[model samples]
Target: MSDDLQKELGVVRDEIDAIDAQLLELLNRRARCAQQVGEIKARHGEAGFIYRPEREAQVLRRIQGLNPGPLSNENVTWLFREVMSTCLSLEQPLSVAFLGPLGSFTGSAATKHFGHAARLLPQSSIDDVFREVEAGHAHYAVVPVENSTEGAVGRSMDLLFSTPLKICGEVVLRIHQNLMTREPSLDRVTKVYSHAQSLAQCHEWLNRNLPNVPRISVGSNSQAAELAMQEAGAAAIAGEAAAERFNVPILVANIEDEPNNTTRFVVLGRFDAGISGRDKTSLIMSAPNRTGSLHNLLLPLAEAGVSMTRLESRPARHTLWEYVFFVDIDGHRDEPKVAKALAELQQQAAYLKVLGSYPAAVY
Candidate 1:
């Protein structure tokens, strides 16, 4: 209420307003440059190829590195993401598909990776998401691959084996599940619903709190939230976004067993991403069913000085009891050492498929 304090606050506000004007001018200038870039690409007959994951990754990384700020690096990168998304949309709007009824974590990952400027199409199933992109109905698709707590999404892994689309990018979303319902109190709740992965993620918490409630696994957390909206005695476990989307109230928050629960999602597109300095490659390989076949498959990567980040096995769908391995390595396939290793592994393995070499998640 002091005059001096009021004057100081007014002055600061005026300065902020002035800086915002400058930022607006600069943003428009940047958008105009983006438009020019699109026109140049079209002139070279490269129309409909506006997005470049490697390039965007480089830009975001550089921005984060150079950031001198009161705002955190994640916040800075997110602002730039929206800016780029908007500029890209001005050039040509992109259509992205995700497994959803809307408000699913996969949908959130798609938005996080692609931004709100892109049109989002929610599919009924993961297979539908892949089919949408494969049929050219969508430029890209986002699908959940794995979770830190509950492990790999079996359906997504199975679909990846058959889908011709490559992984162009990846998003890692930290999940915070909440118990939500339309009802006012948990005392009235009789049934709990959520995606199987989510239910598993919150298994311990559910057992501790809603011990007597029957837990039902649904296709998506969004679908579960929808059901909660309809049924009086039903509660759904999902993210905060789903609560807002469905106009449901949160009964409890952070109910997952692990506080650091996260889900990894992959963006699928027709072409693989080019090398970004910090990149990761995903591949599927099957070794001949023989002793030492598995060990021999990994030797080349170690010999080539490539570090393996993750390895998982899934049943080869066509042949019963046969297993295929999915591996994530810490380098692009085009790198000299990586190429050498992959070539050696290809010859040694019964089958090999390079899923993609994409920029690693920035954060």
Candidate 2:
């Protein structure tokens, strides 16, 4: 190596070392500040307010907006997320529950939003996750509400109607389903197993590639991977995390029908999130059984100039042939325009329930 080149490399290494030292010092200083904030909250009898979703959302959004990058905005935000997660844990380590055997997309969503510093509990079913939070065993619960490719998660939607929990936050995860198996060759596979939604998402790919193989719908993709690990001729359609966790070999990657398949998960907690600048309000309403009742219910929102993002109908469990409509609007419920629309709609509807207003997912 040339002497000049060696000298330049040494100089760059020293600069990097100095930067690392500075970063370590700053991080420790920040953690100390976080600890002091916790102490102040305790003194004011507001310790439970340490994890504020609105404040965190504002912080992340501001960081992304101000980022001038060699590193992408996402990379910067992710680093800060972990830093904040660590600082929050210093206040109180959060217990989060998600639908899982582990390695499910719901579990991934929980980790993505809460960070690895949180204590994640895996529940067998969506209902179990809600129960865990409701029973005070968990601080929050994460469950998949909808998928871009396959549409709504019916069980999760139904649970939302009954559970007293509020929607405190949302996370959108890009899903990449893979075909994995224990066998060395795909030619030897005779059966496929996966969650019903996953199987549906990869339906076209499965039909085209494994034409003769029978597909089975299981409870979750993680459970499907578990079965594939134990069986010779079985393949599972799941995310890369499941394959890695279960020690299965990937036979095919990106097997879903859509390249941009994404799932939206909601965080359920005891208290509703305060308004973040960019927010979404979700609610359920059942119109009176009359000719123009549904039309009347929606007319106020449109007249009030509030944009409705989504609407889904679920069967009301107590009343036969009666359906309740779940709606997502573009603003927080406390906003004057939104509040006016909701008030008018309440007068026209037979039932109304404001689920919660929460910050929209940041990409």
Instruction: Identify the leading candidate in terms of lDDT.
Output: 1
Query: Residue-wise lDDT of candidate 2 within 165-219, one digit each (tens)?
Result: 9999999999999999988887899999998889988889988889999999887
Alpha-carbon RMSD, each predicted model: 3.0, 2.9
C-alpha lDDT of all candidate models, in order: 0.89, 0.88
* Candidate 2 vs. true structure, TM-score: 0.88
TM-score of each: 0.87, 0.88
Best by TM-score: 2
Model 1: per-residue Cα lDDT over 189-257, one tens digit each: 999999898898899998888899999988777788899999999999988888888888999999988
Report clash pairs, candidate 2.
none
